[model samples]
Target: MSSIRARLLAALLAGMTVVTLLGTYAIYVNARDAVDELFDYQLRQLALSLRDQAVHHSFAPPAETVAEDFDFVIQVWNPDGVRVYFSQPHRTLPGLAQLGYASITTPDAEWRVFATRLGESIIQVAQPMRVRNAMALNAATRVLVPAFVLLPVLSLLIWLIVGKGLSPLKKLARAVSRRGAQALDPLPVARVPEEVLPVVCALNDLLARLDAALTAQRAFVADAAHELRTPIAALQLQVQLIERAGCEEERAAATTDLKAGVRRASRAVQQLLILARQGSDAESPTLQDFDLGELARSVITGHSVLAAEKAIDLGYTGHEGEVLHLRADAAALQVLLENLVGNAIRYTQRGGRVDVAATRRPAGNIVLEVSDNGPGIPPAERERVFDRFYRGTTAEEPGSGLGLAIVRAIAERHRAKLELDDSEMGGLRVRLTFPMPEHPPASP
Candidate 1:
């Protein structure tokens, strides 16, 4: 029953059986009616033929002759309603009645009798109902026997036709099963039936997306390995220097350099990890509503000590007490804010100012900006600054060039638009615009 072929066969065969039975019943009823009309006509004709003759009581036909002629009984009666002459002697017979054609039931059998009078002498022709019924049954059988005999042949034909109709699906399954794991090519569409074309096209689309994802993953791994090589070699050289220190002061100095090298190498590895996580296609961001301004202030607070160490002034300067609510992945947004603020603090000159702000525009779009009074990126290198391991010409800081790349990746995940421009403070400004829902959730 689970198989389509079996289900179809069962349903079709059941339907055919029901139709055949109904047809046979209809044929039997029609045949029986026709036989009754024909026998009744014959009864009337025989009675009429005898009406003109002298059915003499002295010259009665033999019982065997009457039985063999037409399985009928004949009788001649006088006007007095007395038993006159009967061709066949039986256990019961129809009593004389006044009628042209009538049906009478005797103790032995049901009889169809026809009577006609010829000048006060009556002739009756009678036949049993069972004879008519047998004729009807025989006619029905003759008409329906061919259909009954062909039933099994028709069932076999249905099975073969159903199998032929489903052969395309079987071929498709075999073709798909024969492929290797790495074979992401689309299935061929030529000669595909219209009914199955949609499934084929959707599968092809899925295969194409899988291929693209794998290619991107391979390139990311290769780029990450290539970018990590320089920092690792630098750390090794620093370790060697620390091992070959000559005196106490020299050993202390070498140790300090080694510590800085270790910090740089650790920062690079951390950045690579963040970039990899942001670029992953498998992990989807958790979207929720949060106060964007509060998040901006929290990031600035975390980077406050660094800003102070560089003698840079960093603060939030958006609408003072108004809440700027945004719906996005809160964790990813936090990382984006941290990278932007850290970069601004690191690259800004001493005594320079860096400001962070989050604001909601009249159009319900949320905008975030981080600006600094540092040597900004030139217009030509601004676009390339977001590429992994790409440093600007004006960059004088000794650090990995992954901050903006990480920020861009996070922004893209949140469907935000990021742009770099000259700040009003005579430095670089990074702005991100996030689209808002028409009916945003209320603050809790």
Candidate 2:
């Protein structure tokens, strides 16, 4: 669970350290070679000076003096090949031939030698290899020490720079941490990086969904409480009356009230259950092809009792030529039709007309219409008619106000359109228009 900055810094430091080490090694080798060249130049120049002194000035030093004065061993051989002057008289150090640069070794130690002719003799200057190597090692150390100190400083600077570069991320994390659980406002994206724009956009979308869900939950609770309390209170009052009954007659009266209360409570409970089912999940099974006209006819037949009681004529009146094939949940379609027809029957006056019709329009739409010769909805209030618990202008009817809302919900589920318009019989019209199937079978 290492942080990104930590990981990046670790990698950066590792790379820098490796590169610094390699560069340091290269610098060290260069320094060593530079020191070696200096030593060789000094050796060559000393041999030339000694040669000039012997040939021109004849300033020869005694063997003991020469050994003490000179920092290195020296050898002089006469033209006849006899050793004339030699430092380190006991043991002669290894010597090189004339002309080019060379090095020689002896049983005791190794030496870098330079030989030149001095008139009648050869003067050879040989310095011990130990002195030259010590100088090179010192030079290499001088180059390595500064590099070691500078690498750590450079790595620290890089780490700080990386931290500064990632400061925006730290701010974002802090901003998110400080938000309340119920807060669903969009994240502050003004200063966010383009690299993180997609994440911010996704978070904003999630917040919007969460806000919608919370609003729905609140509305549901309020609506349930408001709807359930009425029936529950009615039931309570009815039970109290039954408890206070003085005789059979009084008890009979209480029993009637009790029955009405029970019915109301039962209806409220049913509406609640329907609302619950109508929740976000479209648990309705896959839509099956069904006859809209036949379904409308069946609903009209079922509600004939209401029409009869109200003295209204309930009948279907549209083209009965072909089956009204539509893709929708059959049971839901039946419920929708039943509600529309029943409501029409209940609202119509005695001897009024209630007509159910299903027809396929030329534009390839199936329209299901239920109308009555009763008071129609006002233009201003038609929109609210689809809200749950929204009793319309005709509130005297026994309804949970959920019928039209359920109709709307089902219509949406089927991707159909429901409109309220003037009926042909001059009353309210509830029409559900569904899209025709892509391919329709011709009438037999």
Candidate 3:
């Protein structure tokens, strides 16, 4: 069969054939019962008729001609149960009781017998059971032959019907096969059956997400290429200038420029590395309890030279109680703090102020703020400052614009929130807040 409908139809027809055979057997049994009743009644009446003939004649009569018509035997027995006459002289049929009708077996075969009593003797009439059984077999065969012939034809018709029932599923398969690889449009769900609608809707949602990811990746690549080209070109020019300098002083000046270019390029490369390690579902960083105050102090100490060189004040001003134990990736926290402090030190002029502080709030929350007296980011450009290669409106410093972006990436990885507000130094305030771990040391 070409379809499921056809297969089902064939199966149904085969089942019907089996049922029909059973029905024919039942009908045959009913017919055999009816015929046996009529035959037995005829034998009973024949015995009574022969008895009357003998009584009227008052003689031990010669053998009767009843056997010529009925193809059976007739016998008579005296009242003392002595056999007087036999229809088949080769084998004697046994006389039965004077009751209605009975059956008996001879040496050769079985017989159906009828018996009745006369004045002084009993008469019996019987027929062989083999003849009756043969007749029943012939009749049953005649009735069942037609059903056997029609079974195959009905099976074929059933197969065709089942094939038609599965047509819709085949059509859906073909429609899906014709689509191209990048075709993300949703399949039409309106005409589909209820069982299949959910599958189509899910595919459509997947396609929509794929389209958005592709667009974002394109924008990221373009921005990265644009950002990397500037430093690379500057490094190349600085190297060439160092080579072509005419005097020792000129060569020394070119070497300094070359070193500066190398530093910028190294920073750009480090930013890219941080971005690569920043987002992964599988590689969550190890977290531990760390003192926020200690971390802030350490970051400030690392940047002491920068602050001293610029003549700016850089130090910590927060609670002395170590009540601010935080759960975070320590490495990421260090990177985050270093970037914020570095940015603050870079932007502030000589004699400017930069403060690092970690303060504990009321409800297991620790607030860490790094503020500077440099020109602050304007309100309109603060949001874009976290974007890759996005520089703030008041940013006139010479550096890659990825420091805040790296800070945001690290914060997101740790599920912490970083906010920007107006600093007490009349400049920018970059605050990083995280929940304090429960069951920590009260104070140390």
Compared with the true structure, all predictions reach lDDT values of 0.87, 0.78, 0.78
Give Cα distance to truth, residue 193, candidate 1, Å: 2.5
Candidate 2 structure quality by residue, lDDT tens digits, 1-444: 778778987898788778867876777677768866887798788878886563322334455555354557777877887666666765656743665467777897877777878786788777777776676667667766887788778778887998888887778778788999998899988978887778788889988988886887689779978988887888788789889999989989989988987886787677667666655544765677788888888888788887888789889997876777777788888878877887787777779998889988999888888888898888888999888889977567776787787778778877788899888778999988887677675565
Best first by TM-score, ranked: 1, 2, 3
Candidate 3 per-residue C-alpha lDDT over 1-444 given as tens digits, one digit per residue, 9 for 90 to 100: 364565567568767877888877886787677667878878877887886574332223345743454567777778777777676666655555556677678887788888778778787777887767666666777878887787777767666655555555677678768878667676777777665567667867877777665665677678778999998898889889988999999999999998988888898888877875674322787888788799889899999999999999999988766656777788888988999999999999889999999998888678889999898888788899998888876788987888998888888887678899889878999988775565665555
Top-TM-score candidate index: 1
Runs with alpha carbons beyond 4 Å of true place in candidate 1? 1-4, 7-155, 442-444
List pairs with backbone clashes in candidate 3: 4-162, 5-162, 5-163, 6-159, 6-162, 6-163, 9-158
lDDT for model 3: 0.78
All-Cα superposition RMSD per candidate: 5.8, 10.5, 10.1
Residue 115, candidate 3: how far off, in angstroms? 37
Give candidate 1's error at residue 74 in angstroms: 16
* lDDT tens readout by residue for model 1, 249-300: 8888878888888888789889888988898474888888888999999999
TM-score of 3: 0.56
lDDT for model 2, please. Answer: 0.78
**Cα RMSD of predicted structure 2:** 10.5
